[model samples]
Target: MTDFSVLAQTAKAWPFELARALEKRVAEQVKAGERTAEAPVIFETGYGPSGLPHIGTFGEVVRTTMVRHAFEVLTAGKYATRLICVSDDMDGMRKVPDTVPNPKSLEQYLQMPLTVVPDPFGTHTSYGAHMNSRLCAFLDQFGFKYEFLSATDCYKSGRFDAMLRRAAEKYQAIMDVMLPTLGEERRATYSPFLPISPSTGRVLYVPMKHVDAAKGEVTFTDEDGRDVTLPVTGGAVKMQWKPDFGMRWAALGVDFEMFGKDHQANAPVYSKIARILGHRPPEQYVYELFLDEKGEKISKTKGNGISVEQWLAYAPDESLALYQFQKPRVAKKLHFDVIPKAVDEYLTFLEKFPKEEPAAQIENPVWHIHSGAPPAADVPVSFALLMNLVAVANPTDTSQLWGFIQRYAPGTTPATHPLLDELAGYAMRYYRDFVLPAKTYRAPTEHERGAMAELSARLKTFDDAPTSDNLQTLTFSVGTDHGFENLRDWFKALYEVLLGQSQGPRFGSFAALYGQSETAALIDEALARG
Candidate 1:
């Protein structure tokens, strides 16, 4: 029975820091009688459904959830909370995504609301519906507790009708906040509202001729040069993206939200517009964008970075969450190579959690990732070690790796250690996909060859039950005894000759798990091949 509130107060983890800020905001609002304690504190993450949801979208929701959980702990459940994942489905599609099928088919629908654009996949009624389905499925897979929202649905169902009317009344005041952020040309054509043309059915971005605040209608010239007057409510008109950002906040009474660093510059504009619309803007956390292997910003259209499916195929979702939790404000390279490290780091944190002090545990990421109660670290083997086992064993089935795993961690079975069993499967898939194709075995140098041969023979004399420390010491002696000046060359030689990779797991731990006799036979095979 740990006092989480005490721990949360001193916890330096980013989520706790954010939760404290939110707590303060809620307290002030309650004190001013602006909100009741029973009112749910809103946490929001916005998505653009022009393309399929990507890993960045996953990061935002997961990170926001972490803060939400922290807030729950800090407040001791005194204040209710809500997480809203909203998709900007009413936004017009500007261009076809490079990854989607039938790019030419979507060209005719340019500037139409995404909810109206035909889904090229032909699976859903519209492009926005198809994308929204994918986004919901993606979030649902992670078991996130949230309410899904559609911008189109919100506007059409009259949920945003009051906000739309408020925007109509304060149209000029909202424009004052946006006009300075744009160039002279953009400022001239830009109106807070984009009218949905009744004739073309496309969202008309043309400059407005007149706005009747009392009538909640706008007069805008359509593409055919005919002036049309449409009511602002009931989905007839939607605000531009910038104004929509602030208006959504004002409408939802969102207490907290987070977005990428790209939106940092416009945060003030959004806040100002929210103030003008008569609601306090949410506390915002702007995180750095994730980059691809070549250091370019990850784009959903480009499909350059590792995707959610790609990551889950090679690693557990926990590892992916751990990656999101760490250094969120700093840019990280999202690629296949980053998978192993993320997995191992997650394992390390889980292993440390139960043993850590309550204060220390609060700062640990696994606590926040699991909402304070992390499962026991049942996997005795590291992902890197399991990957090496797969590399060397080249097992066609998981049972083969399980055989080695059972030996290293005695009494462990696939049934007993399900996580380890899962890791074994993940490692096998990773080795087959990534490690096997790039494997290049280099013949050992003269000194290295003699050292390996000596080491192999010595391994035969040792008992099967020897400790990893004992085997590590034995390997060190063999390397030094063979006149190797740099010990790195010894391990490098072992990796190239034995593992077919330039770097690998600690040879001692790998051998202990992979069996000393089996490792000796592997060395003999490598030597014979050379």
Candidate 2:
């Protein structure tokens, strides 16, 4: 098997189950003498243009993409694959966004079929097109390679007519299912695909036929889990919904589709509609909802949600991709703190994995880290040290850091490499603690300058030794010269010279690691400046 195939098979535990089910379905169809081996298989996802697409929206694309990738690996180029991102742009404006400059009085018609939403930006012909275009660009930028299709364009084509006629003929069986599913259904039937207008905060009234048709006959109310219907000026099949689903399937030639769990009923509705349209219904599944960091379900109206733009602001796109690949059935709770950690973790994974043949990808974290701890073979140093290194990094040059790594880490590295950069970052914390906290011995007085001169001269003998013990020896020598005066005071002055501060970490030890020549030169410069 190819690398991609092996990695993919290991990653997908349920592939055999899915493959078996698919084979059985195909065999049954073949036995009926109705199936073909050359038919195109599609992975389709319809996006809503109501607002900026969120991470959850991207999750669908990622999962569907994985499925496509899996099948391609299985077929080894025998089956042609395509992932279609259908933008339901023709949908009407149901809720106005606060970002738009001026939202007209389009609410009454907003929740109607997506084909009717008005473009509030006045940028596109309709709201559906406007939202669809943005979503297409977003999906493309997200590394999803898919063809974009629009509902309005689909309706313009005659692809839906056959499906519609079939639905019209099988309309009674659909009603049989709908009446039982809805319970207490009365005078008229309903289609699951009709755009529902959530006017009056909840009621989904049937939209009037044509702006000129004058009056809508169907009135629907949710009673005890049933869609109770009553007589109105314009009710009947005109108020049904399958027409839209049937039309969409043919227009796009979609093979598989998935929706959120909230629409569990809609799938069956679409399936029956597909049968009525004389076409195969797209294979379907439901996605669970996402939660906040604290583990509560996300709601668009509640405004307690994280946007994709906010996530990408801090995360590399690949980390976001990993989160998407994480189990579709599992709900993830995420927060801001995850950003820095994700960056660190991603780098670690790359370091360990190092190679990617389509089949050998690291699809799960457990394979790397077992029982809450990473494998014992690859240990890492402290994050604090890395952060310190990064903070103190000089953009114009990095020879000094490279020299230190050669002395200590023993490897080729980037100047701004994550670990190195973090190590240098220590200087920032040092400044806050010492440079900003001095109250006495602020600068070297004349006598102190003489003492500093004497100390610097004596330190020349040990210029090559920056180790802690050597620094301690030099400190003892300097301590003997200031018997009556505060020996600590002179030491602070020395620190001011070396690190531009009155006090810092134990001077001798710090001077050693920072290098004897570098420390000596800094002391003289700070003395000259003040």
Candidate 3:
């Protein structure tokens, strides 16, 4: 294995940091003799098909791969492990997907296990397999060693049978952890890989008790203790969630698994299940969810998401990597508007941290990007701020916007920021192609107009040297004059008056940070527009 324990990343992400922690813990396990030297370090990920994989989805795997690479360097071949990707395609259809045509007919069978759904693509052996295989393809491109296990595969291999028996054997303990997490009404079973897919109009489940995929049937005692064979495609994996974590550990020997914060009970529940299974639980890293531009959780299952595929169309894969590199541990909404600024922030960071490993350098210096010492690790620029700056710069005409772009983002000249060239491309594309054109918010109400007139009168009185506090006061006062809510509201009005658009970026900070003259001129333009 490489020297994973102490590997250095100039721009460290959560996974890199987590990798270090995981190594120390594994060493502790080995020293305590709890794990043999030869035991594999299993990195696992579970997937459900609500829609196309998003950047967050790839973030999990890429980060894990980084950790796995480090672990390999450390073990030097003494330890072997693989990232096991469990596609819970057999899970029930939670919602009708936009990607699929007319899933309404599939709705009646919505709660059925995934095994029953006919492959919409009609290519893979089953619908579940088809959904999972897409992910497998993406991972394959990344060249990570992964085992794509469907629920069907696990049951067919009798892997789940052992877990089911254990769940029955450890029934009380399962509920002890389960009830507290899922609530008193929910059932506690021990399967994580179960899924529900749709087939025909009827719902089918892969019975939780005993599923046999080989014969396409499940064995269960029909309450009367009579052994019955149910169609495998109808029912789905029956285990409750908490016990499923334990089953994963006991059956798969999983070493580490990360999840999003939505699964709040996962940690405690997994712990309880671990005790019941007589196996150590996997290391856990819980992450926050990604939101859309409006701050709603990005979900393709609900026909909402700025998907990874969509993101790739605009952002370079590595830029996307850099986006996830900062694990803020809080929910963030991402959208196309983010790109125009993200490009500059990333370029600035790379400029600041120019020293990086050979792997990071391009064959050509002109095109090369190296890590900033801290890689500007955080290029703290806000979209609102940049947009405001742009507003001040003369974007009224295409030529003026280009001129303004040249001044601040000099790379547009090719002599300065070659990266800016790309940013300009993306920015121009976004404005021209993506941003929906609409009328500005209704003309400021009379009270708002009066407040703006007041602010104009006040500012009209002084030509004082600008300061931060003064600028702050100006933004707020201007809003008051306009009868607007606050400085932000004033700025919005200013944008309409200048560019004939709603919502101009930050004005006061831009004026303070850059200068008063540029901001003043921008304001003049806005007053003209209104």
Candidate 4:
């Protein structure tokens, strides 16, 4: 077998930092015979099924998958890697989300397992299954490789029986780790097992009346005033948050798991519970919360922040993939405003990857984003530039973009330039939604008009084809000679008069991209209006 471990040790890639740390920790466990060397490295992501999947859910899985791919590269595919997406569908529904219609109906089903509650939309058998399918659909849209596991199925199939019994045996220790985090009243009645009410069919949070550790059973009184006894090991019970998290890690032998920073305080408690239950907790990754534009954490149930559909509407999947590929610890604002930049950034990285040395290419963000198989061709056009072109040219169809694209990068076709085609589609949508309504073109100042006229005259002097540099120099000279204080103000005037935006891509690149004749005609039209 190829020894990629040595290669992993020497690589300076950003992903290797996390991959090596995990590998080293696991390697120590192997050396001590705590784990077998051939054991598959499992990367797991948790999802809450109380509501539809949001952008944050997409982020967690995409980010975890990126790390999984990096780990695979580090192991040279010698060690097996599996990404498991586990949904906490068995958890009781605490509140009905606003996104669901007629939420009043949900009050009756409160405290019931999400898997058992009727899907408000009536699209599926239950709310949990619908939400889980939504999560799966989002991942499918990105063509991500993963295994979907449901908490409800795991319980019903008896896969969690052993862990349930272990929790009952270590009940007091689990309570000791969790109780201090709760209020005095909650601490007095808290039990790890939430037995399913025999009458109401709801998961009951009421205090456990009796526990038999040896029998793996818990007894509780139903709301109907009758005693209920059931084995906690079967489908009759589910553990609370901390204990459940720990139990899953131990039972599944997960190698890595990630959660939001909001769970940072709870991580140690879960780790302790895992250790007490005879397994060490998986390697933990705590990511900062996805905050709104106001800098508040975006709540999943509020249906706040950009939705997965919303981001995918204006941008491609790779753009969002790049957004999630950044450092997990750094908090990022998720909003529509972030899409264009992220899209351009992804394209920029794609454009640069082929030119870098093998060592640097391996470390490139695009490498990890594309799972070491980045696209070979570099489409020189940027999403922002394309958006501006759409604003200026007002293409009736996507084919119009080909004219401008081929001017700079010849022989580029929709067939050959798939990303640019997709980007053009995004640009049109973005221009219509964000750019068109806000457009307010200013009539150029007389001085600005004169400068533009000079630019028009200078462009006419170019006998040969105009280069971006030459066009840039001419545009710069017009501004400098016409008493503009700096090129910043000059470009500002150009964008305001021409594109009706305060900022844009390099004007020279834009001029060359739009073709000299069309650019000259644009200046003439602006000068006429002035």
Candidate 5:
């Protein structure tokens, strides 16, 4: 038998928000005093399959999986853990996503369950299946461990039939939980189960004419005035969003789930519905939504934000994971501009993690991002600095970049420093895409030229392999003597003249990474202003 007492204490000291939630959930389960210790803990994440999965989908699953891993550690083999990625594929198609083709044709399928609509891309059996495949591909890209569940399959297979009957048996109770959330007009006629039109094959939201819960059936008149009745068990009807949420909890026995902050209003209704069905609601955590550069919530339908494919083009998956590992509740802007900084920050965390104490290690972001064993901290240079070097050096290949890296960090190779090598490529791509096109180099002033000359002369005093500390001291002295108010302006001027960029990585580190002799020549090149 595993004793989680010590693990529980350790979890309390952990600083991550997700970890803290896991600790609380675990402690609650232990306190419940009725459940068996060996029962599997169900951790779930939800996806709306109305459109292609975006980067936000990636963030949700990855974050939840991180918490699942932490829970496993806390339990220490006392309980099994299962992560299920549930897709709301049974939801009606509200709008055609810009990413999909044939918009005009898809308009006819509006209000139909995505599971019954044809795949516009001709990829899979149904639109929902196509989107589910895309989500699986995206998850597989990151090697995520999860079991995929389709709402359509769950409803059709009788797995959720019992819950559906329960929802109908307590239809009035379910409506009570949702009516308070709706406007006056919508409250006049609302049913928890939306029956599918047998003739038109579309989701019909009309008021249920009669619900025979004992027979597990719902009858409704279609818009065409045709009487339709079907058993609620076999995909003939699907529960509405609020009640469906709780039904899913009771059916799957989900221990934990997370959602966006926008859903905070509907959470209580879901909890109430779960209780009406005689099951406790799953533990829930709300994370802030990702906003576009304009500070509006990113929309999957409008394609207003960057896609997962777009992010992977210019940054590593680990960098994206690092971004998700930050405080989950704080809203952050997501755009191409954030990639370089995130990549550099990831490297910094990797470099610092090995030196931290054992207790401090658990709190480090890299520890959670890597899920315990972080990669070796072999990167001696930052991604920002590498981008700067890529811009100035204009290397035709990675060897030139590796040449500079090998000089200061000797004997490191691509195999030894995979992340650094991969980041070098991303840095170059980012420089070409975002940095190089907009850069305009301003000629240094006469005084600045004199400072550069003095800086070049001082660098000649040190041999080819000067220490970074010595290089920093000399660089600072040049800034002080040049009458610059702050050292930041000094570095900006140097970057403007040398790299044609207004800002760059730490000047001392850059100077030492490039040999002392090469650095002096670069200053001379900047001073010549040719």
Candidate 6:
């Protein structure tokens, strides 16, 4: 086995950097005698089941898993690790998600804990359970290994009882940490503890009339104006979001956690509250939010971003993983158009992995993505090439595409190259859905027409199979010989005329894959149409 500890110490990849930091943290904790075998290093990702899990959710868990894998490599299996996925199901439903069925039905349940609200789809016990199930299903589909923790279960089952009492004991201090951040009106009404109404079963946001820290209870007026005193433990009350953030960290002793940039401003409050509760806050990573095509932040309610399911329909999950792996701190546009490049880039990295030295391999995203044992890349053709093949061949099924694939890569079959066969299917679907509708064939200009005619005549003269290199050279010479100052213009003209798109795969490789005589015929057909 290759030893990655030396490489991991200096590897500049984001995961390795994070792993090293976490390793340092563990070392310090061990030195202080705070770490033990019973308490494993905990990596956490939070999910709000306000809506179905989106690509952003997938990105967080997958990225955290990458860091966890790196930490394992750095530690050389000396310490245990656990990945916990926490769902805040105890949160009150503020509004109905527009995407959910029966939106109006959910309005009556607003202000109630999500665990108490009726499932809009009628699939689970409550809306929160339904959404949580969807989240687990989504993650399971990708084969993620994690322990799912529900806030409702934690609070009701007495797991958080001690922390709840601790919060009650520190209510004034917690309030002091939060009150200044809110406006005067909100501050007046806000208490760290949000009591659940005994009569209505709603999570009440009313102010605490009195906090008895010794008794671990708070007195508050219910919505009906009835004064009531409730114990803070045993699901009788829950902390407001900001306080809850810190309390969860302290209660769980989470070693590391990551959240989106939206929560960055509140980090200090979380950390301070955690310290007040006598626990150090977890190391936090704030990643930039994903944007839509318009550069607007992707919102689950608005449904502007491409979803995990949507991306998988047009590309492999490996491509989606690659998308999540690259430049995570940078805001990226998540849309259908980004799929092809991610697919091809994933292939490029997979092909490069075996040839890379151990030090270089440690830096490769695939190494971290696959936990250092990435499967051999079996696909011989690029996704871009496959998409172009779909464009020109207009194959009705994978078999037709495979025919051309077999010709280009001799002896290759669907059984032998399953990934490539899968790519062929994805390419066909992508072409039909995205490419076909947008394609616009235009007539070639007079000069361009003559150049294509010369190219076509030359291609017809090739008696033997033309190599990609020789064909590329022939096309380049033909472009320059036709008085085109920029070779890109010649290629652009070809794309417009033949593929009915502005951009395409490398012409020589594409031509070699789709036959030379067939390409010449395609040119003649384009000219005839013009």
Whose TM-score is greatest here? Answer: 6
Against the reference, the lDDT scores of all candidates come to 0.92, 0.53, 0.57, 0.85, 0.83, 0.90
- Tell me each candidate's TM-score: 0.97, 0.61, 0.63, 0.95, 0.94, 0.98
Candidate 1 C-alpha error for residue 157, in Å: 1.8
* Winner by lDDT: 1
- In model 5, pairs of residues that clash are none
Encode model 4's per-residue lDDT on 1-530: one tens digit a residue: 43444556667765677787778778888989988878888899989888677777788887888778778777667678889999999999998887787999988999999999998899999999999998898788888899999999999899999988988888888888888889999988888888888888888887888888999988888889988889997689998888899999888988888888989988998899889889878888888888888888787545568888899899988888888887668999988889999998888888888888766677677888888789885667888889988987999888887888897889888998887898899899999999999988899877888888888888877786787888888889889999998779999999999988899988888988888888888889877876
Which regions in candidate 1 have their CA more than 4 angstroms from the true location? 98-103
| Inter-residue clash pairs, candidate 1 | none
Tell me each candidate's RMSD, in Å, in order: 1.5, 11.3, 8.8, 2.1, 2.5, 1.3
Give per-residue CA lDDT, model 1, range 151-240, as digits (tens): 999999999989899999998898788888889999889999999999988988878899999999999998888899999999999999
Off by over 4 Å in 2: 1-33, 105-118, 183-253, 276-281, 355-530
Give the Cα-based TM-score of candidate 4 against the true structure.
0.95
RMSD of 6: 1.3
Give the TM-score ranking, best first.
Answer: 6, 1, 4, 5, 3, 2
| lDDT-sorted candidate list, best first | 1, 6, 4, 5, 3, 2
Question: By TM-score, is 2 or 5 better?
Answer: 5
CA shift of 140, model 5, Å: 1.0
TM-score of 5: 0.94
lDDT of 5 by residue, 1-530 (tens): 33433444455322244555655666676689635666688899999888777788998898888787777665555678899999999998988877678878888999999988899999899899999998899899899999999999999999998888888898888877788888998887788889888888898888888999899888889878987789989898998888899999989988888889989988988889888987778778888998899999988656787888888989888889888878788999888888888888888888888898756666677877877779888777888888988887788888789998888788888888887888888888888889999898888888788888899998888664576778888899999998989888888898989888888877888888887888899988777764
Task: Tell me the spans in candidate 3 whose CA falls farther than 4 Å from its real position.
Answer: 1-13, 69-79, 94-98, 102-109, 140-145, 180-238, 293-296, 301-305, 356-424, 434-530
lDDT of 6 by residue, 395-460 (tens): 899999988888888999999898998999999999999999999999999999999999999999
C-alpha positional error of residue 6 in candidate 6 after TM-score superposition, expressed in Å: 1.7
